[model samples]
Target: MSTAAVPDLAVVASPWTLGPLTLPNRVVMGSMHTGLEVHDDGGAGLAAFYRERAAGGAACIITGGIAVSDEARGGPDFAVFGVDGADERFRVAVQAVHDEGGTILAQLFHAGRYALVGGMVDRHGDPQRAVAPSALPWAAARGVVPEELTASEVERTIEDFAAAARSARDIGFDGVEIMASEGYLVNQFCSPLTNLREDAWGGTPEKRRRFAVSVVRAVRAAVPDLAVTIRLSGADLMPGSTTDDEVDALVHDLLPLGLDGISVGIGWHESRTPTVQAAVPHGAWLAYASRIARVVRGSDHPGVRVIASNRMTDLRDGEAVLADGLLDAVALARPFLADPAIVSRSVDGRFDLVNTCIGCNQACLDRSIIGAPVSCLVNPRAGREVAFPVRPTTQPRRVDVVGGGPAGLAAAVDAARRGHRVTLWEAADELGGQFGLAALVPGKEDYAATVRAARAELDQRGATVHLGRPATAADLVGSDAVVLAPGVVPRSVDIPGVELPHVQTYEQALRDGVPAGTVAVIGGGGIGVDTAAFLTESPDESLRARAFAERWDVTVADDVLGPLPQRQPVAQRTTRPGEQVTVLRRSGKFGQGVGLTSRWVALGRLRDAGVRMVGGVQEYLRIEPGALWIRDEDGVERAVPADHVVVCAGQERLEHSLESALASAGVPFALVGGARDARSVDAVRATSEALEAVRSLAP
Candidate 1:
């Protein structure tokens, strides 16, 4: 091993060769489901999507899961190799990426018991049933048990894998990454919990390894010159699953198979460890990849590249990881969704201009989980590159956006990008309206980065931003069009002692700390859940691997934290551990409106904080010095005692007088975001509305 000092940026920018392919840099655009794979656009939108990202400077791109067979299809949105005209579509996508000087790969995937099948038909016009190693059903999708693949059927599946690889090479792909990670078919065969068979496939460790080994061997024989890589689960993060020693042994056994690369994947879909959540910290899973890298480097094929992935949101973070020389490359999936030009912007030292992924899951993962069309919350034109093309308009107009929140900021930036003269005004001293408040929450520290990037983009586009005051009606007199997004105000509950001195709204409590004692909070919506997290916040929500694992009950193996895991903390102060917080809800889930993937994690944090949760409250009678009176759903009146009170009922639309004034003066104006409708503080809807509003007002 060589010991030398390389600048952090230089480390990640350095290029390396993976067998037949020579990548330009260490950043790989990792695979993510865009939900546009099955769109009826003849693959035009999908082709354009990858084309722009390649042009933006990703060294290599990995396509979303491409099923090897119809039974292996994950859902209706999955693109299969030989079904539904996906082969012709993939050929176009591959050419598009190559034209822009980027290499693309086809990830061969099989969902096993995780497949979502309903109306899919086979060759004989019969409903296709999901096939797995055993006849067990994934607990998450309880009602559907998968059929155990017969001995002959399993051998045919191996051939199907080989056939898919041959087709991928024929279609002009630079590589083929066998999907053996994230609780998929290959991963299921490795885990004892999922694979229960007395046959040659699952009697022991070596037998369990047969399926993945045979698949890799077949795929390699079919495509000899192509990069033959396999993605393996470095850590399943599931209790009573595959052990670390078993995982390392599997890699040791596959060393002489002429493999080109290995990409490390972490966690399972059913794991509760919070692997990719915002609270997991940046580059939290690198140690798993480093461990695999060490195992490979000590073997005969040390030249095989090893890639680290998961929660790598910034290039600077990736640079730091590469500086240690433990891993060869860094793969980022969602960061590319937040900014396709991330590689170009970060390499050029334009960090402020890069839109960072906040890990809110509002638009990406939440939508993809349910098979909906996926888009970015910050970069709205992510999947729709053709529909929302960014170019100079033939005729530009003077457009003014009021309120410098999520909606207003998005509108102002997009309007300026279209060659319009744009100006944004905010009543506060700074921008980021609700985002500013959100940044104060414990796990949401990344929200502040969004504000920083948005502010820089406004300046770069020559769009003026006025702070410390609201947009006056006179200021909009000469504007050709006005977009109002004044945002929302807290709604007051009709309780008798609501205006008590000790009571405060959710906004005030988040911005300024509440009283340091027992507190009773009303309502259990998203904001209320955030309030609970804030009130019961730790002295410091640590970014170190051990602390995170300990907090979430993930038993990390001995040396998985790596050497440089603890250099910073999100917060560090004295916390009142014994302080009690009682949360009351009327009727529903506690963390409603929180993203589907994130709600459980947030609730887990609150549970660890020793919060007293009570639901089914029918009435809020009154409040006094010691406690608040309320009636329960059991037809019983009781007093919830507390030292302080917080109300998080909901939000109301901020009535903009400027809208009526602009209309009276014959100025064309439109209300967007919370100023138009304030059902909840929905940033996904806000950014979507802002994008549509700006595009509709084209020159």
Candidate 2:
């Protein structure tokens, strides 16, 4: 497949027609916490980050969570849009976006009870009280005690919104979005759980809606010409919280104030539904937006547009929602991170070539929480556009890529895009290596999307993909350079009874789709743990305890056990009554590489499903009558019955063969992915190394 003739992305001719000014496009780059703006020079890096997105194709890019005042700053690194006389820095940022033919919006926010006052003071040079509707802090860990804003302070806050809007207009911004969602100051006041005030600002649904309406009215009055959008939570998702009816009433009341659009998301931070928030399918929150759109469109505010965002990554789904008239525009977060040219691809019908976001949340939101620069898990050049622009090399070179996994596919796509003729060879017919298994896990369908996108990109970039062709020294003989991305092979750990008829590797099990009656998994690494979780039935505490006692010489005093040391938190425990399975970890630690949020959920599920976890398995030997004997790490030998065993000891580097072949053929080469190293840490490190290697060879 050749994609050399692909044209540049199309530009939006008219974004909006607001009385006099004609905006560029309906697509809005919603504000997210980029964390880059915490640095001095008023977040110049952050300014450039937004500018690049605008340059790439966003009609309007909203700056990160910008505080309306010092006390309202949520995080240590939140950008301050309310700094007195800081209009010059914002002007520079707006000019950068304008120079790139894109409009910019300032997102005005107040953290309310969500403010990390101590951290804010440490970073921004001052600490102030966080004003909320009622005197209740949002999170206990942040140490923020919310103070009720007095009548005078409430009036001042209304003025603050107006002032912020006016400042955005003065600094050359085309619009400002009032953030009343995700449990920010306005959202906190809107929720019944947080807002208990009596003086016309809390209690009833109408009262709780007062603060947001006042803010919106004030902002609209301050900047009548600016395109003002209000971001609101369509559903609070908390128990005893604001219902959908209340949200509809709130939007209905605010519609008369001349608001331009509404952006809806789910939950406050504390009440966030992980299934809806992170793990569920794409466009999971579309129903919430659909409900809001139905209400807004049904009301007297017929001209007002609706922007639907929240896991709306699939172009087809987004287009369907648009065609259905459920939304005027779809705001994407991770998809834009994966490929800023996503809209362009969708418009051009090259949707398959669009690199999709896998919703891992590791590099994006998780990293932000940990105080690191934002980036994409798959696409390395996210948020670093200034430093790592995609430009063609002055001179063309021939490159050979061994293996057809994520890393190899990435290198091939990037190299071909950089004006290189590339040939990618895979020993197997399939491209994705371990990712093929990763896709099988529940709530991981997006991994398949990432794989398909990479393949499409290689095809579109004019790179030759040779399937089922293992490259040798002869194959690399004439290549100018080679990239050794041949991934690892499963390691064989010698243990007695391991040669039993049913023992097999994870790859073999996946490939063959074997079914076993009773199974035991050996090893405690990420792959091992995942394999154990996959093979074992659901969690059941009583049944699991009975099985453990019967099969292995172990006794469980408690029905529910906490996560092992160095493991992810376990949320709940139950048992799968009839399922027969036991997981024996050679290492003392369990759930080692799981993410904090996922670990809790997965562990809870496993415990509830009756999977027996036996830690500290030492020596293994075959016993009489087809049984397996094990010596505990405590030096006590015991026998455990197992009908089948699965080895999940994990993979090791298989690059020596490819490296030797390349060397023997005198081919200049780079190494990438797990082929570069055996450990999981090699994934990112190898990608970075491969990029550097290509840059060094570029002419």
Candidate 3:
């Protein structure tokens, strides 16, 4: 092992040999469903999608697992490999990637019990029925019980795996990968909870290993010249499922079966584990990949590469993981979805220009999980890259933006990049509007990075920025076009005693400090839950210091105090464990509007804080000096004692005085972001509006 002071990160950008082929770089695009298939053209849209990522500098692209058989298939959105004319379209995709100096691999998979029952047609064009080793329902997809695969059926399934690999190699794929992770078919057979079969495929660890090993052996025999890889879950993160030690043994057993590489995965969709969400700390699962790598390195064919994945958002961290000597390469799914040029930007030392993935799985995974076309919230051109290529405007105009928030910043940067004269104004002294406040919430600091990237782009494009000045009609006199993106204003509930001085809005509470003592947060939306998290945060600086120390293996004193002892009492004092906070909402569910994946982690944090939660508020009677009166869900009235009351019900659009003024002057104005729609204020809506407004203004 090289113990050099600084491990060369250029190695990540260097060529590496995998079996008979040498890849251009160490970076591999992780396989994921893009929902960009063309039913009429046999997945031509999907071809263009992978073409964009390959052009952006991915060394190799692994297509989303292509269904081997009709019975073990993903939904209609997933690309089918062996269907009529589908192989021809896949050949086009493979040529597209190869033309761009990249290799494309086909991930052949069988969904097994996890297959969407009745949602897809079989390989022979019949209604698809899911089959598994045992007749059990997949926990992730409720109400879908799979039929048990008969002994003869299991033999055919193994043959199907070999046929898929042969089909991939014949269609000009650079390699093949078996999907054995994420609670899919291979994973189901490996887990005792899902596979209760008393046959040869189950009842023991070695027997369970038989199915996966047999598939690999069959694929290798079918395609002797092409490379073969397997993606395996290092830990299922669920009860009665495979653990790290078991995965270690399993990989060691399969290495001698002509496998070229292994990628370690963490968690399953049905498992009650937080894996890839933004709330999961960055590089949290690298340790799992290290464990698997150790087992493979000790084996006979130790040269086989190991890839690490889950929540690796940037190249610097990827470089660090590679430097640790645990894994050979790091794979990114959402980061590439967020910015396909992540590798090229990093290679050019343009880290500031790279648009980082914030891991807000809103558009990418969450939308795809519900059958929507996959996209990026920040980039806005993910799946539609072929449709919306960024080009220089034919005719540009002088544009003035009225806010320095996400919408205004995005518009200014994009318009300026298109050779337009753009200027952005902010009433506040800073750039990020609500995004800055969002960063203050625990476990959400990554949002601020997006703001920073926007700022960098604005600087690079030379867009004029005016801070501490609100754009008005006078300032827009000479502008050919004006954009109204003043964002939104907090709305307080209408009730008696609502105007009390103690009643604070969510924004005010975050900008200012939470009042000392008990606090009651009203509303259970994303804003409310986050505010509750902020209020209930540990007050001990030492505790936070200790946490950081333990996580990074640094040393911290237990009672360490900072300079200015009197002013920073909390820095030296112990935690205030008795400090209480209550969250109330009119709706039954909490954390609405929070991204589906991150909501789990957010709620878990609030639970750990011991926050008192009450929903279905019958009424907000009034507010007094020491308490607020409200009715509970059971039709009972009560006085909730609190030193401070926070209202996070929602926000109202700011008054449109600027719009009316621009209209009177005929300034050819537009409204973007919360100024136009305050229903769901998120990066997706804000960035989408900005991209559309900028593109439409072009002649």
Candidate 4:
């Protein structure tokens, strides 16, 4: 295969000036809530996390939001400023990054009404209440209303921002980025929906934006040498919020405040528009950044660059976006988590070897939302660099990786990289097993890229791959150890009419498209929902993009984004024209196994496509040539019009009978992925276990 990059990525590799700072490239490792902010190891683990990405060639890395006050925390684990023992933590991380010739920034943040974690503890170990512009109760906060910030409190908050910036500079941070976007405290103060005050900080749009301007003015005065930037919302994506002109006007308000850059963010936490989910097309939000850049360039402060973030993960897409000459830089968060060396690989023109973020959010966003430590599904060693170093093993051994699915692929690559001689055996002709099928689904093309990356890595590490070869006891005779991961098969349900010609397994439906007619899918797990999404998606790329826009109401235009961008109401989107798909589950939500952050997006996609989701299906009455009958929750029998019934009730382990046979042959082996457990198809767990299995085999 050719190693040459198709697109000329010279533009992404080029440098651009942001005020006083000259970045090495246009790729910025955007800030993410790592949940390591509250790690038990003080700052050692957090230092490792940022230093690894810095070592991987990130021109500049922005740390996750650091709360200026306890009342401003987005969650409990959020990093809080002015707290005890914070300076040492900041110094440790700063030293680690500086040692690698990298610049790190502290992101000053406040949550306002969005602080739902019962508020972070104060510097004196006393609890504080969530504070906001108004005494509004957030829906997720369960009736806990934020205490309306008094005028005095608001003034103190601004001072806190300045103090935090000064403290960050004192701790050796290169700069500080204000977290004023994505419906955070500053953004909430700028929106009418959240800010219901009439004091100097409220009243009109100007007053609503005064809070942000004041923050910038104070921070600039406190630390004039700090490379200061702000993350402002190009579009809040919230209904009845800041207008497009208001957002544009606010950009002009901050241009003269000694700002260096503006990183454009989109969508609020409660917004209906899905911004960063996999369902969203790559670079869907770039136009918003371009809009902001136009405002900056048209003004006197054109030197202050604009950054495009959210869904702009791929380096190729980043190159294209930058080549079009709209924005100055592309900020990627999860992509860095997936592959820390993403920028380096692109710089070396080794794009094929980069581990692509599939945008599943299984580990990163999902865990962050629930206040759990964040990691990557594709790369399990993301934040655990200190625990799982990539140093070559002193003793090399012959390792046979049985099964070339995701688990086998990850294990083979890791083992080979650790100085083990590996041979991969697959029952199928191709490598990816379940993941390849998942890639067929709409908006999931990146899933296949993961398999491709692993394959290339295995080859680069000198691992032998045997396609269309199934391992047996004889094949494992000379192997010092084995990593068994034969993967799974479609689970069989003994329901009536399964033997009919109309019935097919998920594997069959994914490989061969179903006949044109209403389709009925059994089960409502992640795989089931994926199968349903695949059946209903348009085959043409243009048509698919169009449908996605219609369903989510994406604005790819250069016009300023405002409130209520969704063309169709939530209720009306359910009635949109599409192929009829019925997803039946015995109980629970439609996307049961999916992560909380993405589960709603997947279900919403199905709902928008006119998919009939029938939960609490008491009984599967029967199936005929053209339809299926089922007992509803109310014990009412109904006929679902369907030409074909696809079974996606999950999977059972494929019994290759190799595990026992290999053990009897006196071969030491470890079971991973489906070979070890078949309760459900969890790619996150499977991949992590595979990496751990390799570590266990090390001498």
Candidate 5:
């Protein structure tokens, strides 16, 4: 296959300058919470995190929000710029990025009322108090109200900002971006909703802008040669919050402070109008930055640059926004998590190969909230970049990838990229296996993007793809190693009524179509409920709603009577009146078939969708010319009506007894997809295992 032409991804030189430096690219690595910092040492881990991105291709890497004062720290692990004796560590972090040929920026911040001081103990092990504009706490809690910043305290805080900036410059940082957005301290003072003080720093927009403007001015003065940037919230997006005009007026007033650039972020997750809770589309936050750019263009600060960021994942979106003069640069957060080489791939015209972020939030923000090391849901090698760097093998070997799902694809891509000759075999005509079924769920189209990206990468790396081929142990006779990635198979119970014509497996219903109407899905496991939900779609309601309805009809059957034990909701599940749905759950060990997280979401959706729960159906009997006859837990036989029955039980690993047949024939073989295992997770794992096995056998 001929190589495709790459796109022109060269960074445009901006005429606008920042202090004594000029950025070559408009792609800025925005300040992101990695939850990898060590509270005690504040060491090289955080520094290396920034340096890796710099080495990957970011023009400017902004450090995660670093609190300038002890009282303003949001969490215990947040990096602190004011920590005593921490200057050397911060200097090393800055130098790491500088050594990697990238500009580094420190984001100085104060959490204000958002501070978890009382919840977070000081280094002395004393519980601290949280401070804010008013007595208002976060929406989720009503803990201790913060004492309003006194006139002297406010002045000291401004000095802290300047001091932090000065310290950042001393540590070799190219500049400092004041984090004034996302409902932090500066943002609290900037908005009327948060700052209700009668002091000079409150009331009107001009008064509210005082604290931020002072910080910018003081920081610029402290670090004359270092570029000073302001990260502002263009609009609070909260009810009774700062309006666009109010934000515009504040920007206009603050532009003359000689700041180098502006970054516009959105929504406070804890605020009534939190960005995380908002259902806004991708790049929805760019409009605010565009408005800021227009305001700056009208003012004397035409040379001031503007950066836009908010869930931006596609380079095309960034390119269009920049081309239209909406903003000077676009910032991406999750996309970088999904694929660190996004810019490199785009420049190489391999957009299809880009492993797109599905916005599942499972590994990124979700994991951080639970105090786990951050990772990507689809890409397991995210935070482990340095630990598991993909290097070319000294000797080329043949690698066979049995399953073509996410894990298999990742393994194949990695092995092939490492200079191995890889062969990926799929039992099915297409790839993805169970993930393909997942894509059919509402709001899950993004999952399919992972498969597409894997296929693209495999094609690019010249991995041989053999479709509709199932390999056995004999196929690995001459191979030095063998990987068994045969995917999973459905685990079906030998129920009396399950053999009826209306009964079908979840996979069958997905690949083949079922008539729309009332449907009873057996088992309330993730796959069962998900399969039921996928059938509820009519191309009218939102995908989320349809998925919810499907989830509702699925239930966990309990044989012990009383009430059915519930699983957590996966997608929002809802069912309309008169919708035909029933869930049968067996007692004891028979019902535990799904992962905990997926089970929760699935159960929640099932209950919300009004799915009927029928438990203890061990002795179901078919009633001729009417409903089906069944026996309850008390050994009582009963009759229940149903149009179609779908089996959603668990799956088993793939088993092929024909290994000797193919191996004896001296066939170069591979196994792929669900033919490896009945379980989805195992199926993905098998793909890589199979690939490694093939490589070992290759001479």
Candidate 6:
């Protein structure tokens, strides 16, 4: 098999000037909170993490948002630039990026109303309250209305920003970025929905913009030598929030404040809009940045560059956006999390080997929200880059990895990379077991790239991949060691009438089209919800044609016989009026195995599609001709009518017999993935476990 050639990224790989510094390339590592500073070492873990991206060819590495004041502090674990000994603590971090010829920026932030009272106590050893421009809280911050900031407090906060900027410059940072986006302190003052006070800093657009402008001007004056940049929200995506028209005026007012550049961040944390998810189109927010850049171009400070960010992962798209003069630099966050060396690999003409960001948000944002150190589902060594360095093994041996899902593929690649000969066998015709099915789900197609990246790595490392080949005990005889990742077997619930007509498994319903009229899925987990979504939301051709006409801004002619085929709403693609899907689970809440970042979207899609959801079924009585009887949570018996029943109860690990066979064959073996634990659903668990297993093996 021949590998495809890599794309030419000479223009994308070229240098560009930002203020007084000449960046090595156009790619910028956008600031992202990793939650790795939970330790008492004062950001050693955080610094090392940033160093990895700098070494990987990032031209500018922006540190995660660090607090600037005791009242504005988010948590004890967060990096603080306004506190004592801050300069000494960040010295090593600044030197690391400089040593790699990469410019580093300190993202000075203040949580504002988003700051929790408990977090304040943890950070300052004294309880403090949150203060906003007005008494408003984010949608997620319900029941925690903040006390409005007094005029005096606001002035002090501005001074805090200046002090933080001065501290960053003193610590050897090349620049300081005021985080004014993402519904934080400055954004709260900028947005109409959050800022309502009739003071000098609120009420009117110009007044609301006063707070952010003051911070920028103060920071510029405090640190004359360091570059001053501001992160602005391109779109707040909230009702009554700052609109694009308002942003136009806001940018016009801020450009002359002695600012060096602007980074356009999109959406707020409380936004109902899809911002960074895989569902959002790549470079969808470029227009927001382009509009801001145009505003700057018309100003006296046209040299102040606009860095386009949010959902920008593709190199080709970045180059095109930059070529069109839409943005001076492209910022990527999760893509760097997936592949720290993405820019280096692209420059080396090995783009095919680059691990692309799937934008699942499973391990990154979701974990950080729950107070866990952020990691990546595709890349295990994201935050632990310094801890998990791949080195050559002491001795080489033959290894067999059976199964080609995430675990099997990961193990095979690890073994081969460690100077061992590896053979990976899969019973299916293609790789990616459940992960493949997940990618096929609507709005989740980005997951397919994960499998492609793993396959490319396996091939590049000289691992033999055998599809449609089931490995037997006899095949493991010549192997020094065998790693069995045989995947999972769907476990069908034993309902009395489950063997009746129109009854099938979730896989069967998906592979073979479900019967028309009505469908019922048994289980409310990610798999079950996805199956229901697949059944209810499959696109129709007539609907697609109408949508196409509307998207192209074309006026379609009415049909000669009557009106043209009517378009169905994207959220309500139920095929026909009578056709519906009912999803049932043993528990009350749905999306059992879904990640925190994607759960709301998944459930929202189901709700918008009008899928009937029922939970807390005490028992499954039986299946009848047109109805299935079950005991409700309250011990009341009920029957749900359906045209077809799809079972997505769970999976059973079937590695016992294989284990016995390998033992009888005198082969030492280890179990991985679903073969070891069928309960493990997320790819993070499976791949991490597999890598640990391979890392411990004696050659």
TM-score for all models, in order of appearance: 0.95, 0.83, 0.91, 0.95, 0.76, 0.88
lDDT of each: 0.83, 0.68, 0.77, 0.83, 0.66, 0.77
Could you tell me which 10 consecutive residues in candidate 2 have the lowest summed lDDT? Answer: 559-568
Among residues 3 or more apart in sequence or in different chains, the pairs in candidate 1 whose N, CA or C atoms overlap within 3 Å are none
Q: Is candidate 1 or candidate 3 better by TM-score?
A: 1
Best by TM-score: 1
What order do candidates take by TM-score, descending? 1, 4, 3, 6, 2, 5
Tens digits of lDDT, candidate 6, 475-504 = 888887788888887787889989997898
Give the better candidate number (3 or 5) by lDDT: 3
For model 2, how does the per-residue alpha-carbon lDDT over 441-475 read when each residue is reduced to its tens digit? 43454566767888887777788989898887787
Candidate 6, after superposition: displacement of residue 280 in Å? Answer: 2.9
Instruction: Look at candidate 5 and tell me the lDDT of residue 575.
Output: 34
Q: What is the lDDT of residue 364 in candidate 4?
A: 92
Q: Write the per-residue lDDT of candidate 4 for residues 396-475, one digit (tens) a residue.
A: 99999999888888888888888899999997999899888877777787787789889988898888999988888898
- Model 6 pairs in collision: none
Cand. 5 Cα-lDDT: 0.66
Residue 324 of model 1 has an lDDT of 65
Task: List where candidate 4 sits over 4 angstroms from the true fold.
Answer: 1-7, 82-84, 557-579
RMSD after CA superposition, every candidate = 3.0, 8.6, 5.0, 4.5, 9.0, 5.5
Model 2's number of clashes is 24
Q: Model 5, poorest ten-residue lDDT window?
A: 559-568
How good is model 6 by TM-score?
0.88
